[model samples]
Target chain A: AQSVTQLDSHVSVSEGTPVLLRCNYSSSYSPSLFWYVQHPNKGLQLLLKYTSAATLVKGINGFEAEFKKSETSFHLTKPSAHMSDAAEYFCVVSAFGGNRDDKIIFGKGTRLHILP
Target chain B: GAGVSQSPRYKVAKRGQDVALRCDPISGHVSLFWYQQALGQGPEFLTYFQNEAQLDKSGLPSDRFFAERPEGSVSTLKIQRTQQEDSAVYLCASSSPREWGQPQHFGDGTRLSIL
Candidate 1:
C-alpha cells in the first residue's frame, strides 16, 4: 500500500520570506515521489520528482524538495516566497501493485498563500 | 498542442443524464491516466491505460464510469446516469513510458457540473 499525507492544508507566507510545505509518505515498495503545483483553473504542473538518484530535487520556479528516507518525508521549500507562487501543492507517491500495475496516490493538498 | 488536451472545458448536465469527456494525449506517449478532482482537493486516480490496453480501472468510483482508449492515441471517459456527487473536474495526463520516476503531463481538464 502507498499513501501520502500533506501536513498543512494551508500555509501563508509573506513575500520575500521563506516557504515550506510538509509532506509524508508510506509505501511498501521503493516509491517515486513528486511535488506538483496547480494554479486556479490551470492544469497540474510537476515541480519535481525524487528518484533514487538524488535526495535533493530542484524544480521549476525556484522550488525544491528533499527526500528523507529516515523520516519518510518529502517537504517542498523555497528560499523566498513570491506573489505568483500562490497555488495548491500536492504530494504524490507512485508504486507498483502486485500485478505490476502502476498505482499513484495523492495527498489532500496544501494551499500556499503569498502575502504581500 | 504538444501537451495533453481535454475537451469540453466546462460541461453542465442534469442528474441522471449521461455525458462523455475526451482526452488527447501527447504524441508517442505510451501511458495515459484519468483522475477526478473535487473542489480544493488533489486528484484521485480513476483509471490508467498503456496504449490501447485498459490495464487498470480499480480506482473508478462505480460501474457508471467507463473509459476507453481504442486506438491508443485518444481516450474518452463516459459517465452514465450522473448524480450530484459526480460533479468534478476530470483531469487527463500522459507520460512517455511506463518507467519508474516518470512525471506525467496534464491537461487543463473538464469541469463537469451535474445539476
Candidate 2:
C-alpha cells in the first residue's frame, strides 16, 4: 500500500521566515511524489512533483520539495513565508508502475498560518 | 486554456434523495478522476476513467455511488439515497495520462450537504 504521512497538522510562522512542512511516504515500488496547496473554498493546486528525474523539485509560487529516498521523505519547503502562502498543503504519493487505475494516496494535510 | 471544471459548486440534498455531479476535463485529457473530501481531511479516490472506459471504481463507498464518462470528456457521478455521512466536497481532477510525474488538475469542487 502506498501512503503518505504529514508530520504537522498545523504550522504557524512569521512572514519572511523559512517554512517547512514535513512528509513521509511508504511504497513497495518506486513512487511519484507531489505537493498540492488548497485555499479556503478552493480546489487543490499542484505545487510540485518528483518522478525520479530530480531529487530537488521546484514548483509554482516559489515553493519546492526535496525527495529523499533514504529518508522516505518528500518535505515541502520555502525560503521565506508570505501571507499568500497561508493555506493547506497536502503530500501525495502514487505508484510508478501500474494500470492507469493506480490510486493516489494523500496525506492528512498541514495547515499553514503566516503571521504578518 | 480552461482547466478541469465541475458544475454545481454547491449542492444540498435531503436524505434518500439522489444527486448527480458533473465534470468537464481539460481538452484532450485522457484520464479523469473523482474524489470525496470530508471536513479536515484529504481527498479520497472514488473512481477513475480512462477515456470512455470506467477503469476503476474501487474507492467508491457503496453501490449507491455510480460514475460514468460516456463521451470520455465529460463525466458524471451520481449518488443515491444520500446519508448524512455522504456530505462532503466532491472533487474532480484530470490528467493527460497515468505516466509518472503527470500532475492532475483539480477543479474548485462541489460542496455537498445532506440535510
- Kindly report the fnat of each predicted structure, to 2 decimals: 0.80, 0.85
Model 1: per-residue Cα lDDT over A54-112, one tens digit each: 99999999999999999999999999999999999999998754674476888999999
List the TM-score for candidate 2's chain B: 0.97
Query: What lDDT does candidate 1 reach at residue A83?
Result: 98
Off by over 4 Å in 1: none
lDDT of 1 by residue, B17-115 (tens): 999999999999999999999998899999999999999999899999999999998999999999999999999999997777798999999999999
| Poorest stretch of ten by lDDT in candidate 2 chain A | A94-103
Label model 2 with its docking quality class: high
List residue ranges in candidate 2 displaced over 4 A.
A99-101
Give the alpha-carbon lDDT of every model.
Answer: 0.94, 0.94
Quote the chain B TM-score of every prediction.
Answer: 0.97, 0.97
Which of the numbered candidates is closest to the native, going by highest DockQ? 2
Residue by residue across B20-83, what tens digits does model 2's lDDT show?
9999999999999999999999999999999999888999999999999998999999999999
| Clashing residue pairs, backbone N/CA/C < 3 A, model 2 | none
TM-score, every prediction: 0.98, 0.98
